[model samples]
Target: MSKWTTANIPDQTGRTAVITGANTGLGYETAAALAARGAHVVLAVRNLEKGKAAADLIVGRSPGASVALQELDLTSLASVRSAAGQLRSEYDSIDLLINNAGVMMTPRSTTKDGFELQFGTNHLGHFALTNLLLDRVLAAPGSRIVTVSSTGHRFVRGIRFHDLQWEQQYNRVRAYGQSKLANLMFTYELQRRLHNTQTIAAAAHPGGSKTELTRNLPRPVAALSSLLEPLFQDADMGALPSLRAATDPGVLGGQYFGPDGFGEQRGYPKIVGSTDASHDADAQRRLWAVSEELTSVSSPVI
Candidate 1:
């Protein structure tokens, strides 16, 4: 079968999409393609200036694409709450929520909330945001939530429940893996909760792509990004799996999508399998409960 592309995305007219960290790279590409296809795309980002520029670029290319900008810093619960409240007031319903923003292997640091940067920003932030916005999403017809995970999820064995914040010791790669694994677990658990609802939850990954996410990696590993650019796909190509997960009509709840190329790196989007660790039911439930407790946010379903 031929590979799926943005050209296959159905007419997204009348749909409203909220994308996090959409100022550049894969997030920008996903927003641009969706806007071009007639979705009213909201670039939910940490940087408003960059978000506006991204929105302008999408309008420039799509010639009147419906695009808007909203500020969101996932590391801070205050910021997430403020953004969600504002969004809830402004938009009556949200058709798609793309938890696309993330941080990589940065030096050990904590968020404004005092949680580890990666775990806080990548998993906790999205988890809270999705739950806060669940009402709008549930109200919309054919709505979906697509959280972006990564191949890095395979690096960790499982969610370290006792040391979720990496307070014991910091292995940047391992922490990142735990966060990505949480993303998948959250997706599946959400799907289970929404089984009776119209809204569906799915996950996707952009395999080996050249994006600013690598800016936080160690200097040596970061440098390898450019050297491996020939092997790595560009941001637009990398955005395919996400774009597919967000817009594809045939997609089912709990499905995970990724690149179809060698080693699942750099190709068209296809349904893919995650690591055995990512599918742990007990882990998923525990993480969901722990996330709610940590963030002080509750899932709308329960």
Candidate 2:
């Protein structure tokens, strides 16, 4: 079979897609591709100004593309709730919920909710948003929930349940790794819960893409990343794994997509494997339980 590309994305006409952090990078590319294919794309962003700008850009590129915006800040559960409520009120069903926004390695900080910034924004934020809007997702036929993880998931051993908040000691890299690992664990657990339903949960990684997500990288790391910039793909190419996972008819629950090149970086999208730790059923469940406790949001499917 030919390698999957944007051309292979099935007709998404009449579908409603909500993509978090759609103002730039892989999310913007994914939103543009889907909107071009006729999906009513909702840009759930933290900044309405940037969101509007992105929407305008998409519409400019694809005349008549249906694009909307919703203000969301993952660091605050209140914002997630507000965004989900507004989305539920406007759309009867959500065909796609792309949990694509995230924070990379940043200095020790807390969210509006007092959790570690990376874990709070990247995992808990999406966790709450997903649960809040799960009903709408389930209402749509053949719907999907796609979370964007990263190759950094392999950098950590597993979820640091003991120091989930990183109050003990802080390490930017490990925290980010835990959050990305949580993303995969959440996807797996969600798929397990949705097994009897039509909606499936899948995940993708951008695989060494040139995007703003690296803005939080420490100066030394950022300098090294700049030195190795030649190996990174552009945002459009970075989005293919996510696009394929969202629209490919062959995709199944619990599957992951990433680049096909060396080190799973900078190439065509293809089905890929995550760390064995990511697939541990017990770990997935534990993370789900802890996420619920932290976010005070329960899975609608359970």
Candidate 3:
């Protein structure tokens, strides 16, 4: 284990990788790295214009990188369904489904479906997309589903079972934490469900990478973060954990990857442990059931 980096990613030629939010930040870096390695990369993004630009940049950098774009807005279930349908119709198999897009702490708001914004976009949206595309992923040999969670998952005590949508008192930090925690729980549960299949589920976190995700932070917090920006790793470095989790031949289902530096914030990727709360089997199952009910999407594997 000589520090897992993009160099460790096995040849991905012929593989189809669909990365949500691939237009920028960690998603952009992840897509660029995979495309450079010869994977047919799909930029699943909300803004088609930015996605095209990202695709162009990838092709420009890699010379012959294969990149495509699909319109997707996680805040809208209809958009998620449409994107998944279009993908299914185009690609017979998907080797990698990276749930990499997310919204961090933001003011209380609701999605088109009337769910809290962060929880809706960061957790429930990806949940539905993963289920809708599970068949295609399963069809591919040695496929993988990698969800990008966060170290922020440790900020919350647990999933707010009673007030998951924050209809009561809305704290942006806790809401974001709940969504991230849901991400890890989802991965662990998905791995359990996919045990009989070749497809496995894993998770990764960028570990305080400087990315556009911080745009939604409050003014004072944003100012403070900006002052501390030098301490944060750039998006390219941040993407290593996800790249490793997605393409490392030795990765196991249910494993998580993150930076190996102080506080797991700025170093190369390595297998890391999540909070004890994240490992609560009952909570994971409950969250899965609730996610299905909320999104109205059934798990394809089950």
Specify the highest-lDDT model's number: 3
Candidate 3 whole-model C-alpha lDDT, 0 to 1: 0.95
Better of 1 and 3 by lDDT: 3
Q: Candidate 2 on 1-302: residue-level lDDT in tens?
A: 45778888888999999999999999999999999999999999999999999999999999999999999999999999999999999988999999999989999999999999999999999999999999999999999999999999998999998889998879898899999999999999999999999999999999999999888898888999999899999999999999999999999999999999999888999899999999999989999999999899988877
Q: Deviation in angstroms for 218 in model 2?
A: 1.4
Q: For residues 1-302, could you state the per-residue lDDT of candidate 3 as single tens digits?
A: 96877887889999999999999999999999999899999999999999999999999999999999999999999999999999999999999999999999999999999999999999999999999999999999899999999999998989999999999999998899999999999999999999999999999999989899998997887888889789999999999999999999999999999999999999999999999999999999999999999999999876
Candidate 1's residue-wise lDDT over 138-243, tens digit each?
9998899999999999999999999999999899989999999999999999999999999999999999998888878887777777687789999999999999
Clashing pairs for model 2 are: none
> Model 1 clash pairs?
none
TM-score of each: 0.98, 0.99, 0.98
lDDT of each: 0.94, 0.95, 0.95
